[model samples]
Target: MWLLLLLPCVRADSRCKSDLISSINITAKLQSDILLPCNFELTLFKSDMTADIASVWRESPCKSELVLSLNVTTALQSDVLLPCNFSPGLIGLNTTADIAAVWSHRNMTVNNLVEITLQGQTMYWKNYNRQIKTFSSVSASGNFSILLRNVTQSDEGLYQCDLFNGTGCRIAYQEMHLRFDDSPADGFLTWLVTAGALGGGVVLLVFLITIYICAKRSTNSSNESVSRELYPPEVPHDAVEYTLENPIYDAAVQSETHSSFRAEKGNSAETAVYTAVKKVKRKERKPEEVQ
Candidate 1:
């Protein structure tokens, strides 16, 4: 009898275990429709889950606190979506709550843009109206994301989303920036400075190359001129060392001519050539022999 009772209790315990999720995994895009996967749920994800999700899980006196995750960037006059979704155990179980997304310019507290609310309404604080809307079925899907249509320069500031439930209230803050393009002159000035720097570099390089070539050519010409000056002009090598050797043949010829002239009779009346014999000093070829 006790065994039969324990079997029923075990079956009931197994059913309850199957209903509760063991682990949840999800992946999503920013500022877009959040997908609820029936296959997997999203549980407390952070490693220190107790610190962040204690408010979502604790009983009766529960509290909610939000963290600002991402900053949004957009251009003026464009329709863009800002992302703000809070995940808690209550949003998944109840499928609704007092969820609100408010956009506020810094220093303008009274003029808040209560653009999107989970109660399926859009309201403004300063009596201003624009096409700002949030998804109606987002609560059912546990997403409280909003969309702003035709944004303006004045729309640039901080945005907040406050969540309220039986737990407590949590506030999330995100910054929105309106981007502007640089002025025409600013762009032109940057281009002008860059072009001038590049052009100056090119000109300086060309000038340096020209100077190098000219200097090399000048050095070569100077070397050639120096060589020319070293070897002086117009003095012949043969003229510097040549000697006049008379060979004494002229004296021998005059002596022989006088002998012949003496043989002739009428040569006495003309310039007479006399055969006078004298010893000629014979110099040795390399002069020291004679010395």
Candidate 2:
């Protein structure tokens, strides 16, 4: 008789234990963070209580065996998005349902990163100093995804997402594996490009300077050649010597003429004349032909 009364609770527990399984693998670059998608649809039913004792009874229209696995890779100091969403239609449009989501990491010292609670149109969040965040209107859309800001090596681990109904019974479960890349090659490549640009600039400057110097030397040499052509030097001439053998008058003739003129003109006026003379030596001829 007692077993018959507990049958309903056992069946309800078994139904809640059934889950849907999924798997995903992602390869992300070191430049940006990665998004892990976890989306599913569920039907939530109203809880029932037994008359004799207070027993929570819940139901779900899910498969017997369901599993979801995600592999994500990202860089250090990058933000990550762990997506988790469910269909809100099954919660009923005119009815109010209490739904809660909890995000935790197994390897992290602070396991509970975020906790969200939704009561119909109202939503509440509990996180660690805003390090983890979720949508403000999570109740309307049934999106329980969390954002991890500035992920580091400590954030690389297995993350679990659990969903509970008003009765505090877990209805859904999800798992995600976070990982980091071995090396960050993007930063190194950027550095290399910058260095190459600087080197090219230096080489270009040197080439320009060399061309300027060569042009200056050529211009100077051309100016000197033009000056030599425009102005020439004067040449020196040799001097010549001259000899005068004849004069204007003889000295004895001039004296005799002067005396006759003085005697003839004893009672008249006398005239005087001036002359310049140069003497030369004469060579004698041989006189032995008569002997």
Candidate 3:
């Protein structure tokens, strides 16, 4: 009966010793590189205290297995990244233990651990050149982050972390992706060029219209001038009609008078007889015939 009671107690003791690790918490914007933070708890002997951590790996939602194992620290060094930070109270593994971190796609690793000593902050990476660039964190106790910068699309992968300096290890994991985006400057420049073209076109159109108007006005002025020269204001004219029928008769009468006077002077009797015959002929003719 006592063995049975102890059996339940032993089972409870083993269960209590089991390590419980929290899942990594990660948040990031789309099209930006992110480092999914992974942290874990571990049970270790006092001799097993070192900065090196082990059993770090990564898994993706789309995959069923682990991808890359990080053993060499040099391999974890990013061309554009700073080193990671180790948790303080949980740090100091045995010197013989190697620093190992593994992830998917042969990219993730644990290079160094930052000692966190403040509150209200955590460590993360901004990518750079297809690798980690910056590591930053804030904690109330010790260094707590590895930051990366200038991440490229190819740097996207899954990551898992563990404090494995001892027999018992704590584990946590997160997902990360790197994204590349085109520059908006190109779009802006294109819009600028289009606007410039449109403005130029409008100005050109206005100029053309102005020229046309000026030309039309000039043509109209020239036409007016020509019209004035060709057809000037007119003057009124007065018209009358007259007909002459016996102008030569008047001249013949005068000549006859002069000749009769000259002949009468020479012979009074001949002249008196001629004058009486002439006067009788004149009385019988019309008044218009006498001239």
lDDT by candidate, in order shown: 0.56, 0.62, 0.43
TM-score for candidate 2, residues paired by index: 0.39
Write the residue-wise lDDT of candidate 3 on 1-291 in tens digits.
899889988865765464656665688899999987655445442233332232222321122222223332112223322222344433333333422222223355643222222332233233222333222323223233344444445444433333333233433222333323445675788899999999999999999999999999999999999997876543221221111343334334533544444444564444534654565566558676867
Model 3 TM-score (2 dp):
0.25
Question: Residue 20's C-alpha lDDT in candidate 3?
Answer: 56
Q: Which wins on lDDT, candidate 1 or candidate 3?
A: 1
Residues 1-291, model 1: lDDT tens digits: 999999989966754454655556878788888866555444424455456466666553234344554567765567777666655654545435565555555546635566555555666666445566667566445455667788767666666655544333544444444344555676898999999999999999999999999999999999999987775344322232211253244344543544444345444412321211121222333467757
Model 3, C-alpha of 227: deviation from truth (Å) = 4.3
**lDDT score, candidate 2, position 231:** 49
- Candidate numbers, best TM-score first, in rank order: 2, 1, 3
Ordered from best to worst lDDT, the candidate numbers read 2, 1, 3
Per-residue lDDT over 1-291 for candidate 2, one digit per residue giving the tens place of the 0 to 100 score:
999989988987975764766788899999898899977544433344232223322345232222356887888788888877656643345325566667778873647766676642323345464567677476556677778889888789998877666655666767889998755586788788999999999999999999999999999999999987774432211221112433233334444534544445452221322222322211112234434
Total clashing pairs in model 1: 1
Worst 10-residue lDDT window for candidate 3 reads 234-243
Pairs with backbone N, CA or C atoms under 3 Å apart (clashes), candidate 2? 20-66, 20-67, 21-66, 21-67, 21-68, 22-67, 22-68, 22-69
| TM per prediction | 0.36, 0.39, 0.25
